[model samples]
Target: MKISNETKIGVLTAFAITIMILGFNFLKGKTLFGTSHTMYAKYTNVQGLATSNPVMINGLQVGTVYSITTDKNMKEILVNMTLTKDVNIPVNSYATIKNNPLGTTTVEIRLGDAMQYLPKDDTIRTETSAGILDAAVQEIRPVLGQVKNAVKSLDSVLMTVNSVVDPNAKNNIRGILENLNKTTAGLTESSASLNTLLNTQTGALAKSLNNVSSFTGNLANNNDKLTAVMTNLDKTTTNLSNLDLQKTLTTLDATVTELKASLGKLNTTNGTAGMLLNDPKLYNNLAATANKINVLLDDIKTNPKRYISFSVFGKKNKSEPLKYPLPDTLNAPYIILQK
Candidate 1:
């Protein structure tokens, strides 16, 4: 029998549809030809878990997630997994969802050591694990904040330093340092000159000091003689002080009193001395007699042959006559001319 073209197309289409169905089931990890153990787990969050995500045990692919749905209460997510019949799990095992470095999600079944096996439809305990990126981000978060604070503090310190330091202050400091250097140099030069001057004067200064010392030593050595001289002077002063200066002064006073009394009596014209002082006529007679005697003596000096003759030859020498000077008419006091 020959088949129609429509029938042949229908049969090919049916076969293609069957192949697509099997392929879809294979991709969903459903073993249509074999049997598997189904298990359940509940979680608050799924973290992008989906059907057909692989389930593993010890890095071995043992099953896949079969379905995920909300529970009847709508409060928790419920996950159903289809495990291989050969992979038996303990009753106390956990189902943990984990994210990989590639950002894909998977479920890992951690087996427990209990002798009793988990029933096929029982719920497993659920957990979640952090990815590499998440753990790294968590570790670096605090350190990033601290580094930001340190950078801000360093910027503030730089601003303070910029405000405090100025060009004028730097110039003033430089000038001060220059002056100090000049002063130090002057002091160094002067120190050498002073040392030279001291060296030159050292011997003279020492000799002068030695002379002073010797003078003082001489004074010290003559201290006893000085004491003796002072003692003699003290004794002379004491003896002079003990002398009767009052008695001598009294004798002098008595003699002066007697002389004054005699002077008074003579001035009164009561004695010969008084008569001589008071009598003007006697004084005139004495004055006339003195004038006569003076004239006679003068005549004798001029004409000696008239007054005396030499008898040796009984001859007289002729000479000029002696003339007497007339006495002055004014009365003057008697003043004797002494030879």
Candidate 2:
């Protein structure tokens, strides 16, 4: 039988609607023709969990979140999950809403070892997991606080520096840098001069080094002479060391003492020499006797006949005895004239 165009259009539209609804439900993890179980969980916070989010069991999606609602007092969030898979969930199993940092939120079911299974529409234990962002924030919170404190300390230090560094201080610092540069320049000049002074061909240091080398060569050539000299010096030192210096010094000390005693006697009137040295009257008398003897010798030399009469003809010539000494006729005289 041929249908009307309107009726055919209506049938197509109905089929399209049915297909769309099935797709929508399938995308929501709902099984319209297959068996599915619903479970409920209560939480103080859902952590941005929404409907149609996957429910995972060991990384496998077994269900989806059906709906989310608040309790009568609105003190807690109640979430219903529809399980699409036939896997048994223990009565002691717990469900957690996992909030991801870079992805969608979900419900994860952790199974317990209980033999008994949870029935449909039953309440499951609920827990909330810390999101990656939340955990990172928790880890970084203390570090952020420390960074803030460090920034404050740095700001305070900068303020202190700003207060301490003035225009005059800046000038002084510049002057110090200038002086340091001058010192560096002087050091460079000194280094250049030192290099010049150490030149191998022409420098004073080189000349001195050559001289020293020559001296060392001469010493090397005279090694035997040096050794002989050193031996002689050693023998001399040995002889000196072997000498009885103490006995010599004792004898010298005794001689010096005797000489000192003799000198002391001479300084006093204890001996003839001392009387001659110390008594003026005896000294004057000796002087007079020496003068008279000198005059008699002079008179005898001048008048020989008065002292010795010797004649073959018995000549007796009379000459007045020299009461006073005649003037020395000869320039040569042995006695010192006393006036």
Best by TM-score: 2
lDDT of 1 by residue, 192-250 (tens): 87775556357555667778999999999999999999999999999999999999999
Q: What is the C-alpha lDDT of each candidate?
A: 0.82, 0.89
- For all predicted structures, in order, the TM-scores are 0.38, 0.40
Clashing pairs in 2: none
Clashing pairs in 1: none
Candidate 1, after superposition: displacement of residue 43 in Å? Answer: 1.9
The number of clashing residue pairs in each candidate reads 0, 0
lDDT string, candidate 2, 225-273, tens digits: 9999999999999999999999999999999999999999999999899
Task: Show model 2 residue runs off by greater than 4 Å.
Answer: 1-188, 267-285, 294-316, 327-339
Task: Give the least accurate 10-residue stretch of model 1, judged by summed lDDT.
Answer: 325-334
